[model samples]
Target: MKNASPRWFTSSYSENGGVCVEVATNLAASHGTVPVRDSKTPTGPSLAVSAEAWTTFVAMTRH
Candidate 1:
């Protein structure tokens, strides 16, 4: 996707000195995926996880 531009946001549970990831769930509707990146390196590489997989991961984390 050449024109993929995701608006990323960090989780509220993230700590001040802890490593965390930023996610752009907004692109899921059109891209069918959620973009994830390290909060410490915004310009670094990002991973695009499928919506189904992302949902599963989120569900697992809640428990």
Candidate 2:
């Protein structure tokens, strides 16, 4: 999967010296998958979930 440079975005709530979570909304253009990764390891593997699953995860974690 060359050229698979997923752009990542950190959480607005993140405000520390360092964090490792990044969400790639670029995959949302497909309206099917959402990409999640660890910024600490850019070369690390990524997980792609359905948009609905991603939304649910976010909502549940908000509490």
Candidate 3:
């Protein structure tokens, strides 16, 4: 939904001087996807990743 508001946030592990991506997982359940965007440009475009893909990525990062 274009009207949907995404709550974007970076991971706690991000310590590279703000050079990291922000993800809005809040809409995953309803939209079936995770919205990712650059922290430097909140007004810019975002990438919508499938929930499954997001889960896999997180799992890999945890390893």
Candidate 4:
């Protein structure tokens, strides 16, 4: 992920009174991971999960 930056965004379905997490899936292909962070703290530390793990997590949430 050379020269690439995280493009964080919250899901459009999120409407829970400002309590949401942001995710940057844009780096998944290049970095093999997805960066996640709290929406209220953009400058805080982010957690990076493997691309496959992130995919599985989202799919589970849909069910």
For each candidate in the order shown, give its overall lDDT on alpha carbons. 0.92, 0.78, 0.91, 0.95
In the predicted model 4, the residue pairs found to clash are: none
Per-prediction TM-score to the true structure, in the order listed: 0.88, 0.73, 0.88, 0.93
Tens-place lDDT per residue, model 3, 1-63, is 555778888988899697899999988988999999988888999999999999999999889
Which candidate's TM-score is highest?
Answer: 4
Of 2 and 4, the candidate ranking higher by TM-score: 4
Best by lDDT: 4
Which parts of model 2 are misplaced by more than 4 Å? 1-5
* lDDT (tens digit, per residue) of candidate 2 on 1-63: 334546788888887657758888776655567888877877788888888898899999989
* lDDT by residue (tens digit), candidate 4, 1-63: 286899999999999788999999999999999999999999999999999999999999999
Clashing pairs in model 1, backbone N/Cα/C closer than 3 A: none
Return the clash pairs for model 3, or none: none
Model 1, runs deviating above 4 Å: 1-4
Ranking by lDDT: 4, 1, 3, 2
Ranking by TM-score: 4, 1, 3, 2
